[model samples]
Target chain A: MNKFYKNILGGKAGIIGLAILAVLLLVVLPSSLQIFRLNLVGKYLTYAFVSVGLVLLWGNAGVLSLGQGIFFGLGGYCMAMFLKLEASDPITTKIQSTPGIPDFMDWNQLTALPAIWVPFKSLPFSLFAVVAVPALLAFILGSAMFKRRVGGVYFSVITQAFALILSLGIDGNQGLTGGRNGITDLRTLWGWDIRSESAQYVLYFVCCLLLIGCILVGRFVVSSRMGRLLLAMKDREDRVLFSGYDVASFKVFVYCLSAAMCGIGGALFVLQVGFISPSLVGIVPSIEMVIFAAVGGKMSLLGAVYGTLAVNTGKSLFSENFPQLWLFLMGGLFIAVVMFFPNGLAGLWESARARLSRLSPRSGAAKKIIPMPAMPQASNLVETEPKLP
Target chain B: MLAYSLSEIWSILIMQGFSGLSLFSVLLLMALGLAVIFGQMGVVNLAHGEFMALGAYTVYLSSQLTEAYAPGFAPYYFVFAIGIAFCVAALVGGLVEWGMMRFLYKRPLDTLLATWGLSLIMQQAFRSIFGAREVTPTLPEWLMGSFKPTETIDIPINGVFVMALSLLLTAGVTLFMFRSRIGLRTRATVQNRAMSEAVGINTGLIDRFTFALGCGIAGVAGAAFTTIGSTGPDSGSRYIVDTFLVVVFGGSASMLGTIVSALGIAQTQSISEFFLEGTMGKVTTLMAIVFILMIRPKGLFPSKVRS
Candidate 1:
């Protein structure tokens, strides 16, 4: 049984984490959460996708990108454009000046669908775009920045500029894109009513499945040889470079992979929320996504989901009653977490377990804290003696 | 592009150029503060804009007080208000540094997040205190009106005043950073923390004073801003990205680079805005900066340091 458990769960802590996820999915969500709350949780889960990516890119690769929302919004907009086009078919939008164009296009007096929106008409193409566009953009950006050796805070600021520019572009182009109101009024996906309760439940399950898949993928990457390279690079880039590794390639690859994850999340977000807008593509949301990763224990993949949920839940609950206090609390949380709890919830959990073990003094128990090599016991490296003269 | 006579194009260029100067002034002022904080100290103060806003709000409040209590002081109230704004922002900045920022000096990204949170809190506070709507301070009578050197081009007095103020502050800061005793210590600490500590420099004190000084400058920038733009809760945030861009694109720690980059960015944005759509103009400028930074990752004028 122990061998079987080890094979399946990897460790005792892993088993506990899996048990929690199972209970949340199979029992708690189905039995306790109503359709409305369940849908909200699903929306929150979409954010988890970005945080999970951040865990890999920022936590492991040591790349702090303040613009993950750009990928998320890109993925969302891709799906949203497809749905918008389908909903704005010739028959439904016949009353408009432009019969087949989206309502925003009709309002802005465009006669034909823009070239960019054409490929989105194909479901397969749009689905591909959900993953491909963000990843491609990330690849271009990552190559440009990383190849030039612009890491650290410089990378964060540049990515943020990209986010700002993307949002401004979307907001300005009212005719081609949907503008500030965003692409909304999405009804069906391949002739299925996404707004229905049953459909919502199905999407919730789909979200859960995808989330689990992402976690497993992240685990696989982080446990692999490349993951160790990422850690080494994070701690000392010069060392990694000297060791005959193309550090830039690893950075580009990890960043692109993270972008793809965020893109998937954004696509799912559009499905659940039924809208995609420039507002979500901007600097604020991008930074908030980073905070989600930070809050979750950047080191832990599963912790990312928990952190997203905790922060979002706190936001909703606080904003509902005392809107003014929420910002103060959030700001305080950021400062406090960074100052005191640098490792976040996962760190807190490990430390608590360590303290418990110390109190119990358990023999032959699996020790979580790996002890470091002891320094020399002697205070002085060279002893000075009068006889030496 | 819009077709026009050669003379008409020349006049339009002059007009756009003057407008760009105002933008340049604002960007320069904001970037100076950011250069000191993010560039020199390596601490990303995301709430730097809030400091600017605080200055704007201080000016607004003083204007109200002068109008209500001392109608005679209305003309000269702005001069005093600028000073008050600087002091208030500096005090708050010092408090924040002592209470929060000092702890996270080792972590840059954490500093960004913490300051971002501070920005949110400040924004909400501004909203609550000053109402959600934008507030504008009444300009002195002398600071009003415009002067036209040509038939087609007109320059506002306030714009000129703001530009002059930015120049004076820039010069003052340049001198302080290069020549002042505290500035010497600050630079030493930045270059080698352990060495500065060994030499009996209070690095902690220097950090606090430097942060406060940056915030104070941002406050002055806000004061200059009120001459052209109305004060709003989130107005500071709107400029934060632009300011950061100016600092980064100019080469973070280089004063000359900050000035040149600010001028280049402002002109690019304002001039392109004349021909292209507003969004397109902004997008074009940002994309250009990103591309240039890609090529010159250290930026236009990176400071030299031995690894």
Candidate 2:
């Protein structure tokens, strides 16, 4: 029992439990338990999952992908395609129902469910595809990019272009993908009643738990040697390369992990929201995820969760109250965070801890209780000496 | 007397070219401001479009004022307001540069993020003040109507005027950049900031004036644009992407590049529209540009190095 508690507190076990709980609360609990706050929490958890993945890839890799929405959208559209197909009437009825021909087999009169969509009838394959597709793509892209060692603004610009192309492509191909308006109107997931107030509440609960799990796991990952190497690469790439670590592999690992996490987030979001639209995944939303991390504290695992909830909540209210100025307000928040608080909300907490310790120098417990400030100061060597290991 | 005579065909072609030139001129003007900002300051300046919007709103306000207080001089007020919008937008540009952009210089990505935020604010502010629907600016009577150059083509009087104005403006700006003391200093600052700083130049002051100048030119573009098109709070959003494309395709660092790319893009787009359907033309042009960018990421006129 002591070992279990110690291991949990030590980080790895704690993170696993957190991840399990989060998945359960988000994926399992909502439909089963019927809790309300948990559903909202579940939604945020999905966002957190994506945000943390961003931290892993962008935050550590020093390659700011302003178009992660491509992966997020891919996962969303895939799942949406399945749901849209299922509720849609089958073959003979579909042929009778569809005008002229389906967008896909346009020449063909056969309106039966396409072979591509058959796997989606089962939950697992759709789930696997959503995560796997993005993983494969990012893995390939990351390998090509890292091998060449493309860095700085050029890399940033290219990724942004990639995002633009994806958005435009999806918008252009409306027949199969549902195009600009995106897929909607379906309200059930698998066999469960998606509209049931009880189901929604349970979903929200699971989301909250999943979020906690993501935080713990994120904390564990960043706390590991792999995390240290990511930070090192971010700061001193050449040095890390000389130190004999396969920088390419490290990057590819993070890239795929982030993509997979984004997939999970997208899947959870679709399940809860009962719809998936390409609108949710785009350069803007992808960029917004970055803002959440930057605002919450890029270095801190918990900050992603904190930033997502805070900014999204602000977006919800301010967008309604001051529709015109909402962007300005959001910009003000971003500027405020970046300029004044580069370390984000987490940094502020760290500073507060530092001040408390300073106020009571004689209190020996302050040394142990305070740990390290969360700020990613250049001089973190002295401040974070003890707790890092 | 013949409609297809060489003289008539020549005149019609000249008229078409004139319209093309006018379109190119405005595009150049907008592109120039963006070039200066990106060139001198190393900022992508997403809010460049918003600055243009600010200028348009200034014109709108001035129009409203003239209608209410001085009906006789309402038309003349437009000419006057164009200048004012330049100064007004420049002033706002300077303030934003100092408050937000100055701090973000060290972190380029943060600058992109921050400016994006600022753009949203500017967009919403305009939406609230100007309303969502586009504002219709009543053009001066003299500026409206077309001049028949030949049997086939009827050229708008304003198109010729706009073309002439754009040429004069470009000539004036080129002279200012090449010959004037402050202009030379601005160019020097862009060329070699560290060296210029070492030689006792105030790079910071140069940055301010450069940003202001670029924004001022955008104001002029916005004022001129109100003649033919719709001006709304979100008008900036429409132009921002195009301006960036112009700047990026032309090469972010050069005034000459901005002019050439703008003219080239405008001609291709217009001519393509003549050939293909509206959207296909756009798609084709966008694809062609994207393909070009793939080959030359720094754009047509890239500076050799980041410094």
Candidate 3:
């Protein structure tokens, strides 16, 4: 238990980062922002969940899954299905041709509840499906690709294709998946009005708490022995494979973990935003999620959170004011981030601190500062490290 | 399914197959450029689609100009416009290669992100220049009509023209790649960068030229694309995934693989659309490609390489 706690918190630096993030999300933002703005932040924080997962899968494991939106959408859709069911009670939906089905189903002329959606009528089952569905998918895809020794650009392209397939599938099945309009008019969750201001505040807190929890979970994984193997595998797959470890299993596990994290984020997104749509499940949104991780410093879990907030906040501000310039600015951001800042915001902060310490009068003491153990250089030689049995 | 006569089914299949052939031509054109860039150089140019879009807009601009200033030259202008589109797209492609791609050769993933950025910038530029709405160029009268090969089977003249152009372009590219001295040097570099450099090959110049040439083909593709459909700021994006899939599914390095895969993908998609909804057909096509990729991760024809 003590070792687990240490893994989750890292050392002093991780604790400090976690504390700062907690204060900002749980205390500072809530105290400062209006309900409307806080809700927006909550929505942004939900995306942070995906970015955090990317840091684990892409940054740490060197496996970039561009179809994260699939998991996110799956989770959101699961929640939306439950809420829609709750909203479509026989008494309330009596005016429709089908007295107990969702309105979209009625509009699509679905006479009965589809067999697929029947299981989602149970709240516990729906909640379970939110994470399980995404995880199951990741397990299948990850095993298929990794076991075959497929990595790098091929994996990225294939994942993007999956995202495309999912979005089109959802868009095509109007009655089953709510089509392009998506699962809307989600009024309640088991008779609790989710659209209420108080509920929004509560959901916001829930999102923040869950986000922090996810970061800790990510921190745990990154600090574990599995994390070392992942790093070693990323740089030298042949060496790791020759070491008798099942590389594919490790990759599949991390991928599944990331998918589950995205699932939670999507569910929270539906809860906070009051709707879920196919727009969130496509190739574009999946790639955009990657940028959030890239912007935050894919290596830093906390940086992923900050990256999501910063980029999303920038997106909102730019689109709200100078809508025309947003795409250009976003494009430039992508270019600049890749060209100038490959390591992202965390790398910049680390460098700035290094420079500041170098300029300080206590340079001798500064020289003793520990290099961040987590942000290992890409070319870091595994041969220099102690051998793990 | 049983409603149509056997002869009618044959005619319907012929027409659908011809339509698929037009799609195959466009896919081949787009994939050819991607093959050169990604297959030879190992750089994921996400902005390849945008380069294609650039060619389309160039053709659109030329059409508008000829209509306004020189009505008499309208018919001949399309042939020139396609050439102009190639030059413009190639010039821009060369600039982008010099400015961005050169720095990202070692980092394939980073190249993807950077080109995605380039694509966004290109898309926004297109939106700013050409309004957000789609614009279709006026085809020459000769390019507009259908060619009725039989009473039951009619093919669009533009489809035939585009197919011929793509075949010409493909043949030209194949010859240039196999027969030319530069092509040999490009192949040498792909096989062994260090050895090629030792042999006095100017690899950097080859990279830039090949990238530009690829972009030029994409431009021609854009010109071909304008004949069939309208061009919008985001139209290139729609095709980017499908084109990339074709290049990948074909086995990236092999030109023959790309052509075959393009034909297979297009026919499957078109035929499936006949049986299913439009989006469902797309989903089915994509799912099949992904499933095939899972089994054969190296694609249909895995190229022999030392690595």
Candidate 4:
């Protein structure tokens, strides 16, 4: 009984809304005029996968982790490792005879394959890693942090530090991580050639379908009593602790889930871009992921999608057109968003809807909505974030 | 066999110590700015490295200008450039604080995100303005040579100068914070913004100065850093993570914590680098910090918990 489902599925209007979304996703099928928007729609859907997790962690759990990109990078690197191992084998087996063998092995004077990389030669193992590494890391870090009564900025800092160290570690071990060059020259994902347009079309659709599933899962998690309790933790951790709830477990659970979803996004990203690197896993990219979540909206699942699409799409277009001043424009854009649109594009929609409903009070077809504050937020580092007493 | 003369070994140790101290100075400079901005102002300025870059670029530009326009006094133009760079960086810091961050003082995470986005923009800006290549700055003639206590142990004079300058800067900053009227007010505001404001302090101005002072220090660090390393668009990122680590490990909002943590990290990094390769050294130091932080999450000297 999620509000989203109630709004768009329980009633007749909900069915209509569902139909509209379906139509939007399949815009190219019914009309030739909408063909151009198809690819963009798919790309946005992929971005939404990352954003959905943000909504769960930042919006409900009230943890503003600034290193989602690390999770994404882990996932992307996992997938890329499999793809590269499969691809590099043809050229590398002559000098080396191992499943996980890479070109750098010859360069590093190692004829034998590294033990840790052996399992990744299999596709399933890589997929497992995409989910495993980030989950394990998040679990360990989140457990230690939450168990010690650390949240807010301390949590943010520690997570950022974790990301920096990981990326740097990967860079330092050049043979294992492919150094700064990263794994590239990807041929295909499984049997599907990535360079093919038809393959991309399927991949993009998969992103859209997965995005819907991701959203559904997020909604489900956030609607349960557990979700309510977690939100309450955000509002007041001490009170939650006093109530005999294991706040540490709850935080670790959500942190792992967020990391998993980010991993999924990372996998999809490598599939789309056909490349992965240490740079993609660094602190800057990690921070950028948080920014994408921030600029989109921190309240709803849809906002994560909205934020990533807006920022990424805006960057691609603006940087291409005005290479000299795009950054200044982006800086100005962030200033505008934070100052005026605190809730991001999601807030913009809410305001627009409010104005429309206010214009005709007598028409009570749709009720005005004011969302409740989900959690306690008295302990933000800079007096920023929503504080509830 | 790793055999060497006693004097040779002495020189090696001295040289490494000088380099280590110089490296420590740079870390302190970067950490100091980060501490003030993050500690006092509560805005995690992610583009801090960019501000440092601006300082280096300012020095580079000033040198070019002086050489072209006033050849006789070209060598002395560095002092003027450092001042200009400090002002420009401070102004940029003020602009960032007043523009985007002023509103985000409430959402620390939002400030982190927004400032990070701003950092991307700044990097691109720098790349476009000054070509992406490293902008190397040559020091004056008097500062170029090495100090030779022994034939085998010649230490770079520039490194010694950097260490000296860092000590002077730290002492100067200490006086500014504890001795000056404005500095005390800034410290007061950081302690308790609401309390300070109720007592007739202009908390807003204090925020600006705190931010500007941090950026100015970063600018000076950038100017000094030019002699030791190549300045480039993304070079600031190199120091930023270490700076954050120092700021966090030392204790947020404590100047003494900043210095202690910085010196500790720098020395560890240098000594480990000598024993291990660069990567292993960094990994060891970071693991140590992580373990330390696990024990004390709020850091070594974090603000006392409010009841």
Question: Against the true structure, whose TM-score is highest?
Answer: 3
Which residue pairs clash within candidate 3? none
* lDDT (Cα, tens digit) per residue for candidate 1, span B149-242: 8787788999899999999999999999999999899888888889999999999999999999999999999988899889999999998888
Residue-level lDDT of model 4, residues B1-307, one tens digit each, is: 2798777787778878876777788888888788888877767887888889888988888887777788888667777777898898999888877876777887786676677667767787888888989988655776688877766777777777677777878888889888999998988887777898999999988887888889988898888787777789889877777888899899887888888888888888889989987987898898899789988987888876242
The candidate 4 chain A region of ten consecutive residues with least summed lDDT is A380-389
lDDT of 3 by residue, A259-363 (tens): 999999999999999899999999999999999999999788999999999999999999999999999998898899889987799989888877888998888
Candidate 2, fnat value?
A: 0.44
For candidate 1, write residues A185-281 as lDDT tens digits: 9989999988899998988888888888888778777765577678868877886676567889999999999999999999999999899999999
User: lDDT per prediction?
Assistant: 0.88, 0.72, 0.90, 0.76
lDDT of 2 by residue, A180-272 (tens): 767775556676777687777666655565556555565556655567667777777776676566777888888887887777788778778
The TM-scores of all predictions, comma-separated, are: 0.94, 0.82, 0.97, 0.90
Residue range B105-132, candidate 2, lDDT tens digits = 7788777778778887788788877788
Best by DockQ: 3
Model 3, runs deviating above 4 Å: A1-5, A368-389, B1-7
As a whole number from 0 to 100, the lDDT of residue A203 in candidate 1 is: 87
In model 1, which runs have C-alpha deviations exceeding 4 angstroms? Answer: A1-9, A361-366, A369-389, B1-10
C-alpha RMSD over true interface residues, model 1 = 1.0
Against the true structure, what is model 4's DockQ?
0.58
Query: Candidate 1 at B101: error in angstroms?
Result: 1.9
